[model samples]
Target: MADPRPATPTDLPLIIVAIATCLALVVFTAPLTTLDAMTDALGLSPGAQAWIMSGMPLGAACGLLTAGALGDTLGRRRTFVAGLWLTAASSVAAALSVNGLMLIVMRVVQGLGSAGIMACGLGLLGQVYDGQARRRAAAVWAAALGAGVAVGPLIASGLLAVSGWTATHWAVAAVSAALAVMAMSRLPESDRTGDRVDIGGSVLLIAGLACLMSALIEVRVGSTGLVTALLIGAVVLLGLFWRIERRTGNPILALELFRYPDFSGATLAAFASGAGVLALMSMVPTALVRGMGQSPMSAAVILLAWSGVTVVAALASGRLPERLTPRQRVIGAIAGCGVGQALMLAAGTGTSWAVVLPGLLIAGVSNGILNASLGHEAVQTVPPERAAMGSAANNTARYLGSALGIALISVLIAQKSGAGTDFFDAWHAAVIASTAFSVLGVLAMLVVSRPRGVVR
Candidate 1:
């Protein structure tokens, strides 16, 4: 097939970047609305379903560990195209899975594909676009991510209204296939730096993350002894990974990057947003369906206020004055998240949509602005040579925070909402935890920066 015309130096390749960003998040969250259907169809226990839910993020974490270095060496365009194809194939496999275990395994592969796509897409944005154009593209990219995440469940809910859950998976596969074709034709290859990745570092980081994630996922379902063992193993592996990075020549992550005040602040803010607002949002669909007794579609409709505002805020963030730096914006957004969660809790346990709409709108706008600037700041704070690495570091922290939040939230819900307790009671517990995280995020933002040259 003929390659499409290469984008000129002035062009940002916004279409491809936006589509990839949107679709990756969409596919990741599409399963949220269909959890009930999946468990029922496959006769899955809670443990199996948890794996299916957490599998993608786990794989994505591993992908983040490797994809940035790969993009530096293999060329961003190639990695991006490869990721799209992998995602498409994985989606198809997920759609065809006959058992819960099979589906969970496919989800893991899909997550890895998604990680490559996001890492390369962001890296390419830094490469091909410059000055205000680059900032604008970052804003749009962030907005697209929020829109996709918001719309994914809505799309699945709508599909489930008329068709089975498998239909949603098929739709994702078709979209991914089209995107792969477009990327292959339109995206230009990045200049290959020929930087060989550290194989040992990659393995250690992945192993550490896997153990940590496994411990979190199995907490509620597995035996107490098993959970304790996994937790200890996770800590040991992660500690070793940290020590190895300090000694390795080409560490997957540059331990010294934390020396930059802006980079440190941005990374902390990203983690906070992921663990607090983003994590809490993940629970909304389930809460709507089970706690409020709304149809999946109806629940999605109610959430439009939250998700829609986020897109608008993200798109507009780049245009904001320089006086309000990304740090200020992120801090404000974290505070908003805390207030929003508080509002939700104060509204009481009723099914009334009116109770939470104000908080959702407030939080949504803040999240939009925060998401738009978080990683852009991180990437821009670093030297140009390490732009991809900077972006990857911020994202790795964000996703790790997300995985932790999800696991903790799930465990709390399972423990609180049982035969004797109300579902809303459990939701209340989750919201409180989320609020605490947001508060911590705000405080961290305040202290995260230490003036570039100040000693830690």
Candidate 2:
């Protein structure tokens, strides 16, 4: 079929997508500041708390690749609008959750919805914008991501002060509903021809990731038998997924894309960002509140130093000298984040929240650059029609890394806590581990950097 809309302007679509992307991140990070209250109200155990935190990322990891393929094959507008409705409905369900398990399930569903929004939203932008315009749009999308992280805690804190954690969900639900309606009416439709969704590959990939995440969560609870079984299952299922993708005509993830060094570099950067900075930052609120006896609102405000600066830095990234390639920017940004993580070390029980402010601000700037560069690289690395697939692949690595990182951090914290270490000390260990992941990421990127040409 020919294009349904005649020369649609990019501005309106960019606005709608930026809002949806912002809202998705808002939902993802809101729980960070509100975890203590949510835990107390739900009567959650430590294991359950970890699950609630990591569940959404796991779901996104599972759904993003499939969602992207579907969006490209079916219709971007259809997929985007459907994702908004799903998110709105899931927020209401989360608000009504009665227990830890119920809320965890709801969170996973919300993540699936978010996967659709993120994959299709970026795809829509790539469809409408080209060259320098695409770069600017990517930067704007990156800024929206930072803005959401900066604002989510404040929104949650304000609502929690007035009502409770559920109120935040209710507010999210309202905004999501409004966005869905707007998207359905205003967004232009775009879809590629001659591509079919890979049902077998999607099933295998999702199941494998689910098994891996389950094992990670179960390992913390000392369920060695279950963890072992899940790990074995994950290996087998993921191995099968790889085989199927290699053989299938319509693979959900095209293995050929990984041949490009820039693509591989971008994926590595995303994973490192998730596992290192994003994971460490997610735990900061808990540490501030539990370890340092800071109030929830106080923790949120302190985090704003990091997340707020991220927005400014992301918006400003487009202004950086043209000499810096996206890969170079990503490498430098991640390395900067590692340094920031090191600067944040040695926070003992008596340390003030202000001790980490400088580090947070530095890392926030680095994170902004990373986000914008990754957003640009995700689409630029792939064939034009496969922009959604590229976005999905990049995000799959990100959320999967995040799930693993959160689990690892939880395990490290729990081990230290079990050994009678204080919260701050345990957090110090987690920070070190996270920083190590960043270092590894930088090394990997450096290795990929040996190649000289851009993929596109």
Clashing pairs in model 1, backbone N/Cα/C closer than 3 A? none
List where candidate 1 sits over 4 angstroms from the true fold: 1-12, 161-163, 418-425, 450-456
Return the top candidate by lDDT: 2
Model 1 C-alpha lDDT per residue in residues 1-456, reported as the tens digit of each score: 111457663453677878888988888788778888988899988889889888888888878757776776678788888888888999899989999999999999998898888888887888777877777778888898888978888888788778888888888789888888887777788787776778888888888888888888888678888888888887888798889889977677888888887888888877877788888877776676676667777877778778888888888887677666666777887898788767776434554657778878888888888887785776688877667677777787788888888777777777755422366777788888888888888888788764332110
Off by over 4 Å in 2: 1-10, 40-42, 418-422, 450-456
Return the lDDT, model 1, position 320. 72
Tens digits of per-residue lDDT for model 2 on 32-62?
A: 7688899999998887887887787778888
Clashing pairs in 2: none
Could you tell me how far off, in angstroms, the CA of residue 343 lies in candidate 2 after the best superposition? 0.5
User: Looking at model 1, which ten-residue stretch has the lowest summed lDDT?
Assistant: 447-456
The weakest ten consecutive residues by lDDT in model 2 span 1-10
* Model 2 quality (TM-score): 0.93
